[model samples]
Structure formats: structure tokens, C-alpha cells
Target: MIKNKISRGVLLGILSISVDGIAGLAIFPVLLYYQPKELAGLWILLTSFSALLNLAQAGLGPVITRMATEIKIDSTDSDIEKYYLKVNYCYRIVVFLVFCICALLYLFYIRDVLIKSNYLSSGIIVWAIMTLGYCLKIYATKNINTVNGYGELGWDKLIQIVVTVFSNIAYVIGLYFGLSLIFLATIFFIFSLVYLYGSKVILRIFVKMPKILSRKKINFSEVLDIFKQSLKVLILNLVSVIVLNVDILIVERFWGLNVIPLYSALVKIVTLIIAVSLLIQQMIYPYISLSWNTGVYKKARDLYLKGLMISLITSIVLSALLFLTAPILIPIWIGYGNYLGAKVFGPLLLFGIVYTHFHSHVSPILATGKKTYITPAITNGILSIILGLLGAKYFGINGIALGNIIASLIPTIYVVISTLRFFKTHSKYGGLANGEYKR
Candidate 1:
């Protein structure tokens, strides 16, 4: 039965990932063929800037996942209901807070910057709509946690597949019709609707929170505990954005917006690696959390090692394929005789992604509720920014990519070694959790 469930989860994960890749391939041509160079650069910057709103979620989704897994493992009907309510409440509050912050950013900084650049001819309206899109995206993340906690990867991935397909179809149709950025941004609102629907599906099939129990008052203390755990996650999130997504803004600041299209293309394409490599870890995340929380540490370790090995193999093969075909495939996909930055950009960005995911084993560690264990990741990311800047100062774009790759190596090795050692000592000492363990 367990193996059957795992196999089903893996199948669903692959389905969802194929949807993402197809969406990527579908949209790239639309973006390149339909949009001008300047507008395309602004679009990239807008998407990158949107990542900031993600930092504001306060790590609620991850904590909810952890809590949800614990609830599922403890296996009581009432327990699931209680967790669902708490997660719903937290998701609402955090998303509301993030939307407020985005409103202020638009009024004070973003609107004027875009205006000065004279980018996005549709003007502030498109920017406003895009900002709303970011908010919607963040709100939608709650569905992922809710389903994951229930150990329903099939439902989870199925929902993602629908959402990705709809959003990509929307983007392609909008761009082909020469619609404005506002219309494109409207796609996010559509995805949010899909997510809300998915949440309802999860509730009906998995959570089944009773109407009588639903009347219970919100627990502020429980919310506070989640917030405290998520504070570290928030900082780590912000640092990651600073490290990974801030480059286009920096390039725009120093060099100008003209070069942004090429850089954005490189980054987006390289991320295809992560999109595929993470499927196994993400599919098994809730199980790992449940197993570890229930003191089945050996099973958790096995799952983690297995996921990491598979991830490594997936990444290497993709990287090799990237090197082999990028030169030929990229030109055909994005058009010819444009974007001089593509040549060396592809390989370096591939290496950067490899280093970033090098410590895939860390996922299980994070699941164990050691939120502070992310300090090394956060630290490495910040240092990567510094190194990337220095490299940009000396060797330009390729240099920055190399710096990011270099910065990640030490942290990856450190996390792998520390995590293994910690696992050994933990098993030997037989430390207790929630008063559950073996001799």
C-alpha cells in the first residue's frame, strides 16, 4: 500500500512538472515574438520585483505543511479540521498584509520608476494589475500546503497542472492578440481562482472540517507560534530574492534596461533545471515531515537520500542537455541576431543552478522543524550577492553568474556534511520529540 501511494505521488509530480515545462516552452516564443525588446525587459523586471511579495508571507505555508503532516500522522479527524482552520486563518492574514505592502510600494517607488523609464506603455494601470497578480500568487500558495499536509500529492499536482495550463494559455492568447501587460497580469488573478477552487476540493475530500467545529474562534497564540517560526523563513526568502532575482534590477541600474531581456531569458531558462529536479523532494516532502515527526528517523533518512540521489542525476542530465542544445535551441526559440548575452550566459547559469540545488538533502532537515537551520542558506545567498557584484564589476555578466555558482558550493558542502553528522548523532543519542522515540 505504501509503495503504491509513493508511485502514485511520483506519477502526479511528473505530470505537474511536464505541464510547467510545456508552459515554459509555450510562453517563451509568445513573449519573444510578440513583445519588443524594451517592453520585454520591463516585463522581466516586473516579474522579478514581484518575488518581493513572497518574502512577506512569513513562512506560513511551510509551517502549515509541517503542522499538517503532524496532524495527519497523529490521524484524528478532528485534528485535521483544527489545522485546516488555523492554516486558512494564517493564509488570509499574511496575504492581506502583503497586499498592503505592495500598495505602498506602488504609490511610493514602483510607479515613478516605471514612469521615468517610460516602460510599459499601458502605464500605471498595467503596473497596478501586475502588483495585484503578485498578491494573488502568494495567496494561492496556501492550497499547496493544505493538500501536501493531507499527503494528497495527486490532488496537489493535479491542481497545479490545471492552473499552469490555464495561465499559460491565457498568456499566449493575450500576447498573440497584442494585448497589454494589464491583460497578461490578469492571468494571475485567474490562477488564484483556480487555486481557491482547488482548496475547496482539498477541504471536501481530505480535511472535511465540520460545520459545528468551524465556529471555533481563531487561536491567536497558534498563529503567533507559526509567525515566529516563519520569521527566519522570511529573512531567508528575502535574502534568496536578493541573491537570485535581483540581478536584472542591478543590470538595469548600472548598464541600462536594454540588456535585461537577454539576462532574463538566461535566468528563466536555467530555472527549468530546478523546476524538474525538485519534483521528487516536493512530492515526498509531507511524508518526510510525517515520518520524522513520528520518530521514524531511519525511514526519513532513506527517503531523503533517495530523493537527493535522484535529484542529482536529473540535474546532471538536464545540464548536459542544456550545454549540448542551448546554442541551437535558444536562437530558434527566441529569434535570431539578437541578445548577445546568451552565449556564455547559459553554461554559467546552469552551474549556478547546480550549486544552488547541490544540497537537496537539506529539504528533510527543514521538515524537521529546525527553521534556524536555514541560516547557512541565507548566509550563502547574501554572500553570493556580494561576490556576484564583485564579479560583475570585473568581468561583467558571465562574471556575476560565476560568482553566484562559487558562493553556493561552500554552503552546499557544509549543509550536506553537517546534516549527515547531525543525523548520525541524533539517531545514536535517541533524542526524544513530542515524547516519541525508540531506544
Candidate 2:
């Protein structure tokens, strides 16, 4: 069963992400052919908006994954089942409300800024709709994946591929027809709906029978506890996003919106590599959650090490490829003549990618244990902002990239040391066999 899960999960992940990359890559050609400047501006706007939307997600997807795994392990407990459903529903309600409110506030309050910035007027509205669609899709999909990570992934990948293919085709058609950004945004929103519907259908197939709602109704105290738990995870996600994304935002403001497309293009290429790493990380999360729940600490630890090694090796190879190809690829891909020497940024950003990959793997492990506050509060939150600001002011885009490298290093190193120390102490105390973790 374990082997089956791993094989299917990895394959589906690779398949889904490959389609995602192709779809993403297709946009570059569209941008190059139609509107290069707007393309750059759109890149910055989309990336920034994506970061904000992710912040709004507040890591609930992983929380759902954890809860679902727990319920599956203790499936015999009717009370546990009831409580899980109640929490799940409550989370959905709260997240939906919060996302809507935040989206509205941004739309109304920041109208002037967005307009003056020349971002598509309807972009935020489209984004809000898409965000809701994404939340629903994620909630359903996370639970399905947690219950049976491998089995459901095939369907998930197929849905994604379909969406990607259609979306790109729509973009090309829209561009050919001289459609506005608002129209393009609408097309994207419709694509999200398709994904949401597909995910809902898949979810229905896997949900257990005799579904129970909590006998103890969700109350103020329970809401507060969930919010409190979510806040820690939210902060962690926010800081991580800011550390990873703020450079582009800063560069957009300071350097020019035009620089963003070039940088975003480079970042996207690197993200393709990271996405594969993330797939492995995502596959590992449920295993870690289940192993921890069952008191299989050694198994969890071994899994962590294996994921780390894979991430490191993969990141190294991908980074090397980017470093070698950036000079030639950037000009050919985007036709930005001024970006000739952008390859210099490749190696540094690769460091950020490796750190990011490591951080991604460790974060879920911490979150599964519900220990979310430590990394963000201690390492990422304040320090990253200060370093990023200082670096951008002094050194430009490369400086900003360097700032990320530095900021991420501290947290990544700390987590590694702490994890290793934990295993070492456990081994010394005869907590593991041959001082080695179980598979």
C-alpha cells in the first residue's frame, strides 16, 4: 500500500506540475507577441496578488490534511468523526467570510492605487472569485488527498491538465481577438470554476459514509482556538511569502514595472524545479502527519531525511541548469534586450530555491505537530522585512535576491540543526534502532 501510494502520488504530481509548467510557459509567448510592457506589468501584478491570496488561504489546506489523516486513523470513533466535520465546516465558513471581506476591502479601499497603477480594473474582482473557487477546490482536494493521496491524484492531474490546456487556448484566442485584460481575467475565472467543479466531484467519491457533524456545536471558544492555531500558521505562510516574493514587489516599486516580467519569467523557470520538490514535499506531509499521529516518530524522521536529500539534489541540478542557460534563455524567451546579464542572478536565486525547498519540507512537519510559531516569530517575520528593505535600497534586484538568500538561511539552518539534535538525543536515549530512524 505504501509503495503504491508513493508511486502514484509522485507520478500524478509530476504529471500535474508538468502541465502547469507548460500552461505557464505558453503565457510567455502570448505576452511576447502581443503586449510586452503590459505583460511585465501583469507579471508583477499577478505575482503580488498571488502572494496575497495565498496569505488569505492561511494554511488551512494543510490543517485540513492533518485533520483528515487523524480522522482516518481513528475512523472507529464516531465522536471524533463528528468533531472533525464540525471543525471542517466551521473552517470553511470562517475562511470564506474572511476571504470575501478582505477581497472587498482591497477592491474598494485600494481602488485608486490599482487604477493609477494601471492594473486591470476587473482583475481584483476576478481574483476574488477565483480565490473563492480555489479555497473550495483546495478544501475538497486536500481532504481527498489526505484520505488517499495516490488514488485521487490521477483525477486531480487530469483536471489540472484540462484546465491548463483550455486556459492557454483561451488566452491565445483572447489575444488574437484583442480582448481586454478584464476579458482575460474572466476567462481565467471560468477556468477556475471548471477546476472547482471537478474537485468537488472527486471529493464526493472518497468521503466516508455516515458523515457526522459535531455533537458539540462549534462555539466562540472553539472558533477562537482554531483562529489562534491558524494565526501561527498564517504568520508562517505570510513571512515565507514575503521573503520569497517581496523582492519583486520592491523591485516593481523601485526599479520599474518593466523589470518584473523578466524577473518573474526567471522565477517561474526556477519555480518549475521547486514545484517538483514541492510535490515530493506534499507527498511526504500526509505520511509525516499519519506517522506522528501513530507515534511512529522514527518513520517520520526517516521520511524527512529522504525528502531533504531529494530536494537538495534536485535543486542543485535545476539551479545549475538555470545558471548555464539564463543568459541565452532570457533574451530568447522574453526578448528583453536589456536583460542580457540576468544570468548573474541565477546562482544566487538558486540558493534561495534550495533554502525554500528545505523550508517547504520542514514547515509541514512542524505544522502537523501544530508547532507553527517558532520559525516565523524567531527567524522569518521581522528579520526578513528589515533585510529585504535594506538590501533593495542598497543593492537593487540582485541585492533583494541576496537578502532572501540570507534571511532564509537562518531559519533553514535552525530547523536542520534542531531536527538533527532531536534525532541525536533520541538515539542516545535508545529511542531508535541502531541510532537510525525507521522507514
Candidate 3:
């Protein structure tokens, strides 16, 4: 029965990820062909920038997942209900905070871009709508995390599949008709609301919270405690963004917006490849978390190793395919002008491979509730930024890509060695030491 459930979860995860990957690829072409290249570059820049807004959540989703998993493993139904209510209350506060922050950010920064583009009226309205939409999606994340904690992995992916397909279809159709960027933004906002409400309905199917129970007041102390636990995760998240997604901002500052279309194409392809490769680790993470929380340390170690091996194989194969075909396929996909030549592409490919290799292992360590990965992540981000600036100043794009390769190499080695040692210590010690093993 356990194996069957895992098999089903794997199938669902693959299906959802496949659709998401295809949607992402499909949107890339539409973006390039339909919009002006500079505008296309700006759109990509904005999309990446929006990801930074996730910082406002302070990495609460994973903390919720871990906490809920523990409760599910060791507590009663009433306990589960209490925890869910607390999480739900905390998320509402986050939702409001996110909306206000996004609004202030747009008033100060994004508004200037829209004004420069001469789309001030439409753009401001679009930004406002999108901000609210984004907040709604943030609020909805609790529902998904709650579902994941209960070990309903397949159902969790099912909700995402529905949301991704709906939103992507809206985007493609709007873009195909030559709709203004504002219209597309408006549709994005609309679908976010759909996702928010739709997920609540889907979550009820697996686990329902009674209306009376949900109305009970939540303790502020619980909210404060969850926030405190998420502090390390928030740091990890902020630096991860700097390491992985801030390249375009750096490129714009040094090389100018004109080059971003070319640089972002390379980054996009690599980002997509990395996302697909990480599916194995993502699929197994919940199980690893449960295993460690239940004191099944050996099973957790074995699972981490198995997941890492599979992820490594997937990444290498995909990277090799990309390396071989990119010179030909990229030109055909986004036009010859956008292709970043082999010299620049090679280092980024190596960077992706090395980063993926370590991340695949380190994520499992995090699942064990170890903070060992945080310091390495901080080091990686700092070195990558420093090197990235120096490289962009000297060697152009190739230099920046090379900087990333160097930045990641040390952290990669440290993480892998540390991961092995972590498991070995657990094997000898028999259970997690200290407060790391929450019960």
C-alpha cells in the first residue's frame, strides 16, 4: 500500500511538472514573437523581480509543512484542527502584509517603469490588481502545505496542475490576440483569485475544517512561535533568490536592458532544466521529513541518498542534451539574435549542474530539520554576487557565468560532504540530537 501510494504520487508529480514545463516553454515563444524584444526582456525582469515578494511570507510554507507533518504523525484529530486554524490565521496576517508591501514597492519603483513606458494609467491599474492577486495566492499556499503534511502528495500536485493550466492558458490566449501587457496582467490577477478559492474547495475534499472550529480564536503566541522558527528558512530563501534569480538585475545594471533578452533566454532555459531535474527531490521530501520526525533516521538517510542519485542522473542527462542541441535549437526557438554563444553558455551549464547536484542533497538535510544547509547557502550567495559583479565588469556575460561556477563549487563540496557526515552521525547516534528532532 505504501509503495502504491508513492507510485501514484510520482505519477501525479511528473504530470503536473510536465504541464508546467510545457506552459513555461510555450509562454517563452509567445513572449518573444508577439512583444518587442526590449519589452519582452522587461517582462522577464518583472516576473523574476516579483519572486522577491516571497520574502514577505518569511518562508512560512515549509515551516507549516514541517509542523503539520509532526502533528499528523504524533497528535490527535483535535490537535491537527488547532494547528490548521493557527496556520490559517497567521496566513491572513501575511496576506495583508504582503499586499501593503507590494503596494509600497510599486509606488516607489515599478510605477516609474510604467511611466517611462508611457503605459502609466493601464500599468498602475494592472499592478494594483496583480498585487492583490499575488496576496491571494500567498494565502492559498497554506491549503496546499496542509495537504502535503497529511501525506496527500498526489492531491497536492493535482491542485497545482489545475491552477497552472488555467493561468497559462489565460496567458497564451491573451498574448496570441495581441492583448496589451495590461490585459495579460489583469487576467493574471483574475486567475489568482480563482486559484485562491479553488484550492480551498479542493483541500476540503481531503480534510475538512468545521465552520465552528475555524471560527475559534487563535493564540497570538502560536503565530509568533511559527514566525520564529521560520527565521532561518527566511534567510535561506532570501539568499537563494540572490544566488539564482538576481543575475538579470545585475545584468541590467552593468550590461543594460538590451542584453537581458539574450541573457534571460540562457537563464530561462537553465532555470527550466533545473526545475524539472529537482522533481525527484521534491517528490521525496515529504516522506523524508516524516521519516526523521518519526525517528526513522536510517530510512530518511536512504531516501535522501536515493533521491539525490536520481536527481543527479536526471540533471546530467538534461544538461548534456541542452549542451548538445542548444546552438541549433535556441536560434530556432527564440530567433538567432537572442542566442548567447557557446562560450557564454558553457559556464552557466556547468553552474546549473553543480548547483543542482548539491541542492538535491541539501534539501533532504533541510527535511531532517537541520540548519547545516543555511550557512552554506549564505556563503554561496555572497560569493556568487561578489564574483558576478566582478565578472560582469570584466569579461561580459561569460565572466558572470564563470563567477557563478566558481561560487558554487566550494559550497557544493561542503554541502555534499556535510550531508554524508550528517547521515553517518545519525546512524551512530540512533536519533536526532538536540531540539532538531521536534515532536
Candidate 4:
């Protein structure tokens, strides 16, 4: 039954991820053919920047999900309601802070995007609209995550598929009509609203909530403790943003806005491939967290290892196919002028492979709720930036890709080694009997 549940989740996840990835891929050709290349780059940067702005979420969503999952295992209704109260209170505060930060950043730095804007008013309006939408969406994150925590993965991914398909259809139609970028951002804004409502509906279906959940007073001390537990994950998130998303900013700085379309496309392709490859791990994440927390150490270890094997295999095969086909596909899909050749593509390919391995290894450690990977993550982010800056100054785009490969490779090795060592120690002691952890 558990296996069936996970399989169904993976199927649903594949559907949602495929639609989003297809939409992501389709946008490049649509933009390049109908819009200026620089504008395409700017839009990529805009989305990246918007994602970075979500650093305000402070890594609390997963923490809350894990908390709710563990609580629901044995806790009473009132206890669950109290947990919900605390989580919602904390999210409200965080969401408000996100809004303020977004407003201030737009006032000070984000508005400067107009310097690159083909449509000045639309750029500002779209960005502001996106920011507001993002702020509104953050609070819903906990509820969406809680649905997953309850093991309603189909429902969780169903909401994702609905929102993604709805928004992408609007995006494609607007692009076909040669609509302005404002239309794209508006689609995203509307998607957020839909996502919020959908998450709430799905969550309520799984967990029966009391009517008074909204009216309960919050305890700031409990919120503070949640923040304390979240600090390491918050650090991990910061590093993740740097390693995964900051490259475009670096590329734009060194290579100029005109080259961003191709570079961002390469990154997006690698990202989509990685996302597909990690479906097994994603499906098993809640189980890993629950098993590890409940002291089923051997089960958690086996599940993690199996998921890692499948993820690595999927990533390897898909990446090889992508690498082989990219040369032929690039020119045909987006035109010869936009293709960057094998130099840029090769290094990023290796980077993607190493990064995939890193995630496969790192996810189990995170699911265990241990801060084991924080130092490695921090090292990765710092090393990647330093190497990227030097590589950009001396060797150009290939250098940046090489930098990513090396930076990602190092931390991946550390994580694997650490995880193996820990497993070896526990296995010698007969696994779960000695490995039960406090929730």
C-alpha cells in the first residue's frame, strides 16, 4: 500500500513537473522569436530575482511540515490545532516581513530594471504585481506542505498540476498573441491566488481543523523556538539560492544582457532534467523524514539508498541524452545565433550531473533533520562564487561552468562520505535499536 501510494505520487509529480518544464522550454523559442533577446534575458533575471526574494520564507515550510507530520502521528486534535496556530502565526509574520522587504527592495534596487526595460511602465507594474503575489503565496506554503505531510501526495501534486497548467496555458496564449511581459507576470499573479485557495481546500480535506484555529492567540516564544530549529535549513536555503540561481546574475554582469537568453536556457534545461531525475526522492521525502524521526533507521537508510540509486541512474541517462542531442537541437529550436556551442554546454552538463548527485545525497540527510550538510553547503556557495568570479574574469563562460562543476563536486563528496560514515557506525550497532531519534 505504501509503495502504491508513493508510485501514484511519483506519477502525479511527473505530470506536474513535465508541464512546468515544457512551459519553461517553450518560453525560450516564443520569447526569442517574438521578443528582443535582451528582453528575454531581463525576464529570466526578473523571475530569478523574484525567486531569490523568497529567502524571506526562512526555510520554515519544511520545518512546519515535518512538525505537523510528527505531531499527527500520535498527538490529539487540540495539539494539532495548536501546532497549526503556531505555524500560521509564524507564517503571517514572515509573510508580512517578505512584503516589506519586497517593497523596500523595489524602491531601492528593483526599480532599476527599467534601465533595461523595453516597456518601462509594464516592467515596473509587472514586478510589483509579481512581488505582491509572491508575498500572498508564502503563507499558503505551510498548508501545501502539510498536505504532503499527511501523505496526500496526489492531492498536493494535483494542486500543483492545476495551477501550473492553468498559468502555462495563459502564458502560451498570451505569447502567441504577442502580449507584453506584463501579461506573463499577471498570469503568475493569478496563479498564486489560485494556489493559495487550492492548498487550503486540499489541506482541509486531509486534516480536520477546528473552526477556532483562526481566532487563537499566538505564542511568540513557540514561534521563536520554531525559528531556532529552522536556522540551519534557512542557511541551507541561502546557499542553495547562491549555487543554483546566482549564476545568471554573474553571467549577466560579465557577458552582458544580450547573451543571457542562451545561458539561462542552458541552466533551465539542466534544472528541468534534474527536477525529473529527483522525482523518486521527492516522493519518498516525507517517508524518510517520518521513518528517521520514528527511529526506523534501517528502513530510512534502505529507502534513501534505493532512491539515490534510481535518481542517479535517471539523471545519468537523461543527461547523456541531452548532451548528445543539444548540439543538433539548439540550432533547430532557437536558431543558430542563440546557440553557445559545446564549451559552455559541456561544463554546465557536468555541473548538472554533480549537482544532481549532491541533491540525491543531501535530501536524506535533510530528511533526518540533522544539520550535517550546512557547512558543506556554505562551503559550496562561497567556493562557487569565488571560482565563478575568477573564471568569468579570465576564461569567460566555460570557466564559470567549470567553477560550478568543481564547487558542486566537492560538497557532494563530503556529503556522501559523511552519510556513509554515519551509516556504517549505526549499522554496526544494529540500526534502529540504537538509532531512535527525538522528534
Best by TM-score: 4
Candidate 1 vs candidate 2: the lDDT winner is 1
lDDT (tens digit, per residue) of candidate 3 on 375-402 = 7788988998999989888888788888
TM-score of 3: 0.92
* Model 1 pairs whose backbones collide: none
Tell me the deviation in Å of residue 416 in model 4.
Answer: 1.0
How would you order the candidates by lDDT, starting with the best? 4, 3, 1, 2
Candidate 2 wrong stretches, greater than 4 Å? 80-84, 97-113, 117-155, 211-216, 336-340, 367-370, 373-378, 426-439
In candidate 4, what are the lDDT values of residues 202-304, reduced to their tens digit? 8778876777766767778989999888888788878878888767878887877778888888888888878888888878988888886777777787788
For model 3, the stretches where C-alpha displacement exceeds 4 angstroms are 431-439
- lDDT of candidate 3 vs native? 0.78
lDDT of 2 by residue, 244-354 (tens): 676666766786666776667666776777777667676777777666666566676677778777777777777777777777876776675745365336645565575
Point out the higher-scoring one by lDDT: 2 or 4.
4
Roughly what TM-score does model 1 have, to 2 decimal places? 0.90
Greater-lDDT candidate between 1 and 4: 4
Give the top-scoring candidate (lDDT). 4
Model 4: lDDT to the true structure:
0.80
TM values, all candidates? 0.90, 0.86, 0.92, 0.94
Rank by TM-score, highest first: 4, 3, 1, 2
Residue-by-residue lDDT tens digits, candidate 1, 218-290: 7899878889888866766666676667566667766776677766666776666765777788777777777
lDDT of 4 at 20: 80
